[model samples]
Structure formats: C-alpha cells, structure tokens
Target: MTATDPVLRALAHPLRLRMLTLMWPGPLSAAELSRELDVSHALASQHLRRLSAVGLVELAEERDRRGGRERRYRTVHGSPLSDRRDGTPLLAGTLAHNLRERAGRRAPDSEGVTVDGELWVDPQVWQDVRGRLAALAAELHAAARPPHSPGTVPVGIGVMAFALQEEARPEGDGRPNPAGSGPG
Candidate 1:
C-alpha cells in the first residue's frame, strides 16, 4: 500500500481512534489499551497489529509484570497515517455521523458533552488560506530545529490540522455552526 493508504485504513475504525487516544500520553501495551478503551485483549491486540502493519505504530519488546517479553506500542512521529489518501473523507464523515448520533441519544438532564464545529470559507479564498498555513508550518519546522535561545520555551505540541469541503445541505437544516463549535 501507498503511504496514505495505511493511515486511511488505520483510522477507519473507531477502536483505532480510541487506541491512539490511549497512547497519546505514552506507549501502552495491548492489555492496558484493552482495559482503558473497554475492549477485549484480543481485540486490542488485533488493532495494534493492524496499526503496526501500517507503520503508524511501533511495537517494542517490553517485560510484563511476570518478566516475560510483551509487546508495547507507541505512535510514530508526524502522523505515520496519511490524510491525502482515498476513502479518508468518507471514513471521517462516517465517524462524525456515528458520534453525533450517539451524543444525540443522551438525555438532556444528564451531564453529557457534545463536540461540534464547522468552518465556512469563501471558495476563492480556500486555496490561498491552506497554502499560507502550510508555509507557516514549514517555517515553524525550520525554526524548531535551531538551537534554543534565552527566554525560549521548549515544548511538545500535538496538532490536528484539517479542512472540510462543505457538502450540500437541504434548506431548514438544523446543524450547529461549523466554524466555531466547542466541546460541551
């Protein structure tokens, strides 16, 4: 498979996203992921295997409490998964729809949270906006490699950057604003 194909496939499953979130803090074993994500150990192992197959995760030999070698997985740098591959858009939309549906089923009186956001931009400005963001990112990467100066802050940042092309919606649709939504 090409570079982006694995990313698309790795992210195609909801369980994989949960796995990534679990590993965001640090490397985790299949047992830990299963417990944290509420998945069976076998299921967690399968997910980790798939992610490793795509190079999105690296498995290291680590000792379990029993002192036997067990596999631990960590996320690869720079999103070993690709966003430019085919089927990514559809997969993303499906995941969004499922999450929204799940949120909508909760009782209003319950202390539930919902995340929603949308961005509306003029078609003519889209390309220019994206190009400017890319240029800025490249500049940051170039600067990040240089030696730190006095009063500089060294930090690890996790960034999720993406754009959405609006799909046609029927009149009187009642979805929340796209450009400025936050976790509830």
Candidate 2:
C-alpha cells in the first residue's frame, strides 16, 4: 500500500490505533471493545466500521446471543504494514503520539522504561540491528494472551535508527583548515 492509501490514513488516528492493538490478539465484538476502551457502544461501532472500510479489519464471525447477533472483528493479519515503503512515516507518527500520551500521564520511572542513544556503526551492523528489532516487534505482536487473567495492559515499543550527515565544506577555499592542518 502507498502512503496516501485510505488504510494508512484510517489507521493514523489514536483511537483507531488503540482499537487495532486491542484486536490484534483475536476477534472482538463492538460491545467488548467499547467495554475495554471505556467508550460508548456506538462510538466503538463507528470506529470498527471505519477500520473495516479500509480493509484493516474484517468481520470474523457473528453469533446469536440474547436474541441479537454479535459481530466480531479481527485485524487482517499480513496487511497492516505489508507494504513497508509507505508505512514508515505513518508508523513513526503513531509511535510519537503514543509516546507523548504515555509521557503526559506518568513519569519516566513509573511503569515503563525508555532507552535513547546514538551509535555509529557499519552499514551491515545497522541492518542487522534493524532486522533484530523487527523480529522482536513481530514476536510481541503475535504473543498470546495469558488465560484467566484479570486484565491486560497495552505496551508500546519503538526502535529508530538513521545515518548522520557530514558537515558541508566551504565553496571558495582561501580560509585556513578548520582542524588547523596546513598543506603538509
């Protein structure tokens, strides 16, 4: 998918992102999502419909309970970020929004840890690190929930790396070397 795809645009919102995360593990009905997210049933259904419109989610099942049919929604696996060429910016923006929200609610030492540092390494090393990080993220996404638990909390993990550029040189050279090296 391209950056301008409706799916990417639809997934860019905070509430929609939260819904997708909640549905990652399995199928969830609008009522279940509403309870989990503390939202109204109509609001949850609206967002689910939006997600379904973009093909990011699908109707997994429908069951009759209490004289009404409950519609369950599940994320369309292998479709969310399958086209990486256009997903980076969207994912980065989402990550930044999530980080900002989390930071506003708690201190750095409260519930989660944040790591930030700069590293200068060979291109191959950088690629290896990126691959490893991608694997870890996939593992986290596919992880199974613990059965018979009270409730589950959502966590965000992010990894970013990019090359630094060199400073520009003077156009017309009559000036002394910045490093104080003469024409030796």
Candidate 3:
C-alpha cells in the first residue's frame, strides 16, 4: 500500500481519525486507544489492523500492566509519496479515489460552486475574497482547540463559500445563467 492510499483510507472513518489524533504524539497500547476513543477493544484492534494492512501503522511488542508482552501499533510517518513531487502511481490513484469520493458527495452542490464559476468573476472582488480565505485558513489551522467537554458532540460544520452572479446576456434572452468566481 502507498502512503496516500493509507492516509486517505485511514481518514475516511471518524473513529480512525480520532485514533490517529490520539496516536500522533506517540504510540499507545490497544486498550489505551480503545479507552481514549471510548470504543471497544475489539473494534479498535480491527481498525488498527486495517490501518496496518495499508502500511499506515506498524505493530510492536510492548509490555502491558501485568508485564506481559502485548501488541501495540504506531503510525508510519516516513512516506515518500507524501512529498507531492514523488507522484507515485499508488499514491496518485489513492488520492484520486479519495478526492472522487468527496467530489461525489458535493456534486449536487456544484451548480453554484463549480461548473459555471468562470462566468461570475468581477476579477478584483474574487481576488480579494480568495486572499481573505487563504488568510483565514492559515489562522484557523493555527488556532487552538476548545476545551473538551464530558461527552463528544457529533456536530460537524462544513463551510462552502463562492461567488455567483447573473451573466450579461444577449437581448431578448430571459435565461439567467450563474457565473462562478474565485482566486487563481
């Protein structure tokens, strides 16, 4: 399995994402992972197995509470394909597949955000918005996380912003076409 393939597949599941976030700092035992994620040990092990199969993680022997050797998994961060220039076929296809899945979900919302976006440009305005968005993305990533609550919230926020406007049409044509615009 390629780096991108595993990264994408590992991230596809919410539980897996949580597991990854937990493991990012260091390796943890399966029981510790399950407890942290509030999942059953069997389920956590299963996810870890899937992750390991894709080369995203490696299992190691660790002594548990009773001083018995137990299996533990850790993420494999040294992936060449992760460096965009490598363009390995496996990584490319996995990335494409992952993106395609996300695209399929947004296809229905494409009319306003894609397809006809070229027509909506008031070139200057789009540039300004794009700059602001880029700044926001940087700042957001740099922001600190909120304090954890006693229980997890399933709430998810998806922000989609784009410009849409009516195109200047020929005389007597009543059709209103949407134009889309964004930063280059």
Mark the regions of model 1 whose C-alpha exceeds 4 Å error after superposition: 1-4, 80-85, 101-184
Rank by lDDT, descending?
2, 1, 3
Rank candidates, TM-score, best first. 2, 1, 3
Q: Specify the highest-TM-score model's number.
A: 2
Considering lDDT, which of the candidate structures 2 and 3 is the better prediction for this target? 2
Model 3 per-residue lDDT tens digits across residues 1-184: 7465445655556566455545543577778788876789999989988877777677655665676767777666443232334333434455455445446556343443322234455679877976786666445433423224345332221222344444556755655444442221
RMSD of each: 11.1, 5.3, 10.4
The sequence of per-residue lDDT tens digits that candidate 1 reaches over residues 25-93 is 457898888886677999999999998887777865477677676777776646443345467565666
Candidate 3 minimal-lDDT segment of 10 residues = 152-161
Q: How many residue pairs in model 1 have overlapping backbones?
A: 3
What is the C-alpha local distance difference test score of each model? 0.62, 0.74, 0.55
Where's the lowest-lDDT run of ten residues in candidate 2? 175-184
Please name the candidate that would achieve the greatest lDDT relative to the true structure: 2
What TM-score would candidate 2 get against the native? 0.73
lDDT for 169 (candidate 1): 64
Q: Write the per-residue lDDT of candidate 2 for residues 70-111, one digit (tens) a residue.
A: 999988876465435565777678868877875675645556
Cα-based TM-score, every candidate: 0.54, 0.73, 0.42
Number of colliding residue pairs in model 2 = 0
What local lDDT does model 3 show for residue 14? 55
